[model samples]
Target chain A: MKKKIVVCTDLGPALSLLTLRDDLDVVVWPHAVDTECPRAWLLENVQGASGLVVCFKERVDGEVIKAAGSGLRAVSTISVGYDHLDLPLLASRNVQVGYTPDVLTDAVADSAVMLALMASRRTNLTTSLVTSNAWPAFQWTPFALSAPQLSTTLFSPKRTVGFLGFGRIAQAVLRRLTLGFGVSDAIYTPRPEAPPQVMRDAELLRGLMPNLHSLRAVDMPTLAADSDFLFVLAPGGEATRHLIDESFLRRMKPTSVLVNNGRGSVVDSTALAKALKEGWIWGAGLDVVEEEPHVGVKHVLPAEQGVREKCVVVPHLGSATHETRAEMARLTVVNVLRGVDGEQMESGLDLGRWQ
Target chain B: MKKKIVVCTDLGPALSLLTLRDDLDVVVWPHAVDTECPRAWLLENVQGASGLVVCFKERVDGEVIKAAGSGLRAVSTISVGYDHLDLPLLASRNVQVGYTPDVLTDAVADSAVMLALMASRRTNLTTSLVTSNAWPAFQWTPFALSAPQLSTTLFSPKRTVGFLGFGRIAQAVLRRLTLGFGVSDAIYTPRPEAPPQVMRDAELLRGLMPNLHSLRAVDMPTLAADSDFLFVLAPGGEATRHLIDESFLRRMKPTSVLVNNGRGSVVDSTALAKALKEGWIWGAGLDVVEEEPHVGVKHVLPAEQGVREKCVVVPHLGSATHETRAEMARLTVVNVLRGVDGEQMESGLDLGRWQ
Candidate 1:
């Protein structure tokens, strides 16, 4: 008998991997009206399945484990983030967990730099001026709507980029800043436990960020005070929540730009809105937000009139590129295939770390 | 004896250069209500002036030349373009012409990239959604606003950047694309007579664009068909007007992005709007448009409802950064000072080209 697999949602052409394999039986949810996979449907169809492929919206937890029973060998999610999954329960059930990481790194890094560019130039206000039909009356002046330039200029010769988290995504962003914009100086804060490793990785960092002149590991306050462009690319969790609040925003240079591409929760929405209104910082570009997807008129971010001028907000589009999403789907399928074959899975998360 | 110099407009603190030199008698137009130096005022004040400093709007033609008469030794404009000036007439009078160039190249290049990012990601539509209070009702999906990613990805690994005009600003943009975005391939079209130099400058180009693997000088059609990111960074004039018209835009890939930062006239606005509406091209980021400051709801570019999804327009803010404006003002002052002292201006244009 063929081993059965359940895929919670359609991953487009990546489902062609099923036709290539005759030894496995794959079932995908068929629905045109729903936004994401429903839990009741997933629980029912996932019964007796040898493996399950999930999206970010579905909960892969004790309930999922109980539904899959003893046949469940692995669970895969098509996201770099595995927060929706109950890792401790999955590990307890001896189910291998696979995630798509590294592939989306460059795509997210591109968006991070995109945010910086859009934010610093104040495209948020400029675009509004164009779309709102206000450009005709806006008398052209030499310094009118003049915002900071991301690339180094004759007057602003030196540029320093800062990162809230030192990781693959942050490092990729550093390479772009150093190579693309001629930004030579950089500072980043590592995870609290990872502080001592910063000095040992100088040579490694050189390989990652070419032409980087100064790469200093600083504290949160120092990182806030010194950086010309500060990027928040850290993982989102309870511990790292609200890392950038009122005190941190106040420490930033009045001319500096803040970009958060990592986790919206890493920044305080209320504080950022106040900062933009008060001119605590020049502007901001956000790919993620605290009340993202559900963000409305009542939200603190879009509520303030002054914030609209300085801040550019996109609807959580960090890894929303077509190429990145397809690659993620391919990786998600490979993980389930490897797990079913009783071999080591590619990009498998270590269960021991969760314990 | 102090030599008389007439400054047509206020250059902010860059006027301090005038205060530093006691040997020059400077008269500035004092009316704050007027947008630019009024024609009558310029003609009146320019009489018997040793040197004339102009803004982009002021025409330094036969009328002003006749007023200044034999005393005018030089003319400097605080703009990269000298279209308003009667360059041939100035040359005939043995007047050295100075215009600011090279200083604003990087700042413009930065804006070009910002435009590309904004255009590709459809920030034109996304930002409008946020500002217009329509974001609340916009349902979120995995690929709700999925747009092209600017940087190289594993799936879209090879990126080719194209330049319509192979000048300093285009080259700077190429360097940023290659270094900052990990784009390895580049192609550009040179002036009608400058194609042979492309093969000869390989080594020099390696220094300019660090990690570029391939650089091609190709015909217009091939460039349109092949380029992923096409930048139009050429001079604005009748000779180059509508260079990227229907035939050129039609040749572009349906997914390729067009960014014009050099000159607005080079692109045919009607064709681009039609292309956007018809899906002939994916998107466009324009820092310069044919109808720039006067762009209202009646303009063809903004009038097309379908165009807003893929087009991002900013009022001609090519070199509008605070740092760049200050530098341009300072250069404008230096050019005037040099011309008045019978010294070669730092960035004096060669009149031989115009002739």
Candidate 2:
């Protein structure tokens, strides 16, 4: 009998892998159906599914797992973070879990650095001025909408880069920040007893950066106070919620810029809105927001509500590059295939469970 | 016994310097006077002026210089380029000349890099989408408005940076391009043998950049073909007028971005306007246009003109920073003071006859 796999959430790239396997019955969700399906309807329909390939939006919890029952051998998510999955319950049920990691490091890092540059340069403001026809007659003025002087050692002498969580993406961002932007002296909040590779990478970064003054791990307060620009690259969970709040933003210098390429929940959107409204910092560039597609309205809403000129919001494009997405999908398929074959999965989440 | 100085234009930064000496009599023109003041009117107004501080709009030719007579010791301009000043006539008259150089390097370089970054990143398009509220609700397709991948390496196994001119501003820009953006190789138009210090500085830059594949002199065609992005930084005069016209722009790859931080006349704005309209090149960022204050309409006019969307035109702000302007003003003042004292002026232009 063929093992039936039900791919959810518009299985375009991820389902391409199972197309060649004759022994596996792969049910690719039609695009129209995926777009129009209600959550309750989806739950009622996916009862007899043998496997589930999930995405960020579709939550897979105890209830959903219980519905899958005994035949559901494996569950795979097309993302690095498995936050939406109920890990404890999945482990208790002996359901194998697979995730795609390390594939999107370059793309996320590239976006983070791009955001940093965009924030510091005020590209959005100047571009808008010209596009909106607000720019008046060309008269040389002492102060105009201009990019911050990055060539001179203006920010170098007091350079300090901060990361909320020092993971793979954070490390990659650090490398670009140090090498590409002449930033040194990083401060990060590491998880308790961080992995040896993380420490080794930190040491390696320090060695590579000649002007690196300090790379010490610190608490949130120290990180907020010292950093010229902060990168939020931590996980999105209850423990790490609102890592950057009102007080933290207030502590940052008026000239500093904030970039959030990580999870939106890691930052308090209301606090950020207030900080930008009150001019707590220079500006902000956010690729991720609290409520994604809906939050974009905040950028266009009235300035009184604090979502006007200073905030530059993109629609959650942290890892949206063509090359990166292809790599991610390919890696995710490999992980799923490996899990089904009873071989060691490439990036299997070690939940300490046995089948 | 006091030396008299007549400012043809509105009393600019140089006027403050002339006023410092109690022995010098400074005559300021009426603030509302038009630039097309006749020579007869100037002669009648300021009969015995020893120095003339004129702006680009005020033409200073043989007639104007002769009207100032034997008492006219120096003609100082508070600008870097002297295209407006008749150099041959000034040299023949034995009048000392002063122009500011090396002072505006950082500011111009900053602007150059800013234009490069802005152009490559499609800042204008992206900013419009966000501020106009045309995005978010629109489902993002693969062909959405996106920035060119600047991270794409150009050279085989390395990347190359090219410049139209190898002057101080261009060198500073090259520094930022190579260091900040990790450009490896460099190609610049050949110039006369520079001083030992310049050669040593180039050597130091090469030493600092490990991936610097080659730094050679190249012709315009080679530069256009090989360079990922081309910077027009050559001097503006009869020689360099329309240096980058139709053929030059067409030679560049469709993906390449062009930046003009030098004189507007160095580029054929008509050709550039058309190139961008037809997608011959990706985009352009220009600080200087063929006509100042006139080109403001190019940015402000209706979208039917097509120039508004293709170009990011900043009001000529190559040297508008506080730090740089102050420094340039101080230097101009020092030059004026030295000329009045009959001493060797700092940064005095060698007009051949005067030398």
Candidate 3:
């Protein structure tokens, strides 16, 4: 009998995996919409499955792992984030975990720069002025809708940028800033528990951000105080949650611009909203929020209402590009296929920490 | 007696031009509001002025030139575009014209990238979904708002960029594309009325866009056919009016992105609106429009209504950054001061063509 593989979503690339292997029986959620499969349906159908493909919308917790039994050899998700999975539980059960990374780096980096420019230039406010038919009410002044320039030009000198997490995506964004805008200085916080590749990654970062006259990893306090454009690229979890809370925001330069391309949990939205309203920082651009899809009984939440003018909030679209999505889907299929065959997965995680 | 100079707008940098010289008497329009100085007030106040500093809002016609008499040795505008000034009349009367250029290149280039990303990523539509509380109605599908990536990633190779007028600002934009996004090929339209400096400029362009495997000058038709990102950076005036009309847009690839950081008149807004509506091209980002400050009795013009989703329109805010505005103001002062003293101006135009 063929091994059963269940996919929680019917995305094109995910669905295509159903036809990839004749030896595997693939079951996909019936819904055609862009939504998460029902938890009850997934639990009921995932029984006796050897492989599973899921996204952020589904939680692959201990219950889901237990439901798959000892026959579940591998699980691959179509996302850079694996927060929904219980790595320790999967590790103990000897089920290899795989994820899609590096593929979406360029798309996410593009979005980081876009959000930074939008926040700094007040594109949201000014665009609203045009779209809301309020352009006539506001006369053109030298500083009417003016916000800070993202990069150096003839008159303005290069600015110092900071990063909370200096990873591949962060380095990609730094490249755009230096080569595009002539940005020259940078400050970042070194990861407390960095992997053995820190030294090599540091060297690689210098090569990528060539225009930087200074690139130093400092403490969090100094990083907040000095950076003109502060980017949060840290991973989300309990340890890093609310890393950019009120105190950190208060310590930042008044003229500074904050961009959060990392997990939404990294920033305290309430504090950020307050900071923007009280003019603690110039502006902010966010791809994620603490309580997103922020849809409650009323649909959209009121958390972002007061500070909408000073913020450029997009619906968690860091990797929402056609090329990036396709690549992610391809990697996901490859990982699942390899794992089910008991071969090494292409981008499998080393779950040794859990062991 | 000290030479009298009148500044039509009381903006900080323009007003500060008055204090730049002790030998000049400076008069400013007294309204504290952001609107332009009343035409009658400017006419009455401009009389007997030996030098004038004006913005785009005020028309510096033959009437104003006659009111100032022949003693008006210099007419310096704070803006790069001198369309408001009657160039032929000024040149006929031997009046030297000085305007600020190169100072705001970074700000404008920054905006060009901002708009391109906004339009290509469908950020405007996505952002509005969040702001208007309509996100709940839309499910988070894998390809709901997916558009083409602006930069080269692992999945998508480098894109070919085109330029309608490859001048200083366009070159600056190319720097961002090459260095920032890793864009590889570029095609431009060489000015038919070529100056001697075109050869040197071409060489310099090659040096700036080093990542490009192919960089060549092509005819308008070929440029339209080849480019994935078409930039309109030509100067605005009668010679280049409506250059990106129906035919040009029709020739462009449906996946192509059109960015205009140059002039309002260079593109026909109606044609662009139609093109966006019918899916002739992918999207457009315009910092300037044909009838800017596109205001109406109802505020937003009907021409821009149908295609708002595919078009990212910013008010003429290319040089609206604080640093750039200040620099342009200072340069305007220097130009006017030098022209008034019968010395060559820093960025004085060669009015010889009009003469």
Cα lDDT of model 2 by residue, B1-355, tens digit = 8888776553345456677879988876664133434456666655677777655555677667777777777777667878778888777766777877787787687677667656765556555555555555644332234444443222223456678877777877776555544567778765444433457546846665664556777778888877777788987777889988999888887777888888888888778877888778877887777754454434332133555566777656666654455555566666766776788779889877544
- Judged by DockQ cut-offs, the docking class of candidate 3 is medium
Error of 1 at B107 (Å): 0.9
lDDT of each: 0.82, 0.66, 0.81
Off by over 4 Å in 1: A32-34, A198-201, A204-211, A353-355, B31-34, B129-144, B208-210, B352-355
Give the CA lDDT, 0 to 100, for residue B207 in model 1. 70
- Model 1 docking grade: medium
> What are the per-residue Cα lDDT tens digits for candidate 1 across A1-355?
9988898865768778864799988978776113567789899999998889887878888888898899889898888788889999888878889998898888788888888988888886787687678887765446667777777765777888899987888888888888778786889887788747655458645764545678888999999999989999888889899999999999999889999998889999999999989999999998788866656566667556888778887877778776787788888888988887778888899999656
Query: Which candidate do you rate higher for TM-score, 1 or 3?
Result: 1
Tell me, what's the RMSD of every candidate?
Answer: 2.5, 6.1, 3.0
TM-score of each: 0.94, 0.74, 0.92
Per-prediction interface RMSD in Å: 2.6, 6.1, 2.7
Which regions of candidate 3 are displaced past 4 Å?
A11-20, A136-138, A192-210, A295-306, B11-14, B136-138, B191-210, B295-306
User: Residue A166 in candidate 2 has what lDDT?
Assistant: 77
Better of 2 and 3 by DockQ: 3
Clashing pairs in 3: none
- Considering only chain B, what TM-score does candidate 3 achieve? 0.89
Q: Candidate 2 clashing pairs?
A: none
- State which candidate, 1 or 2, has the greater TM-score: 1
lDDT of 3 at A13: 59
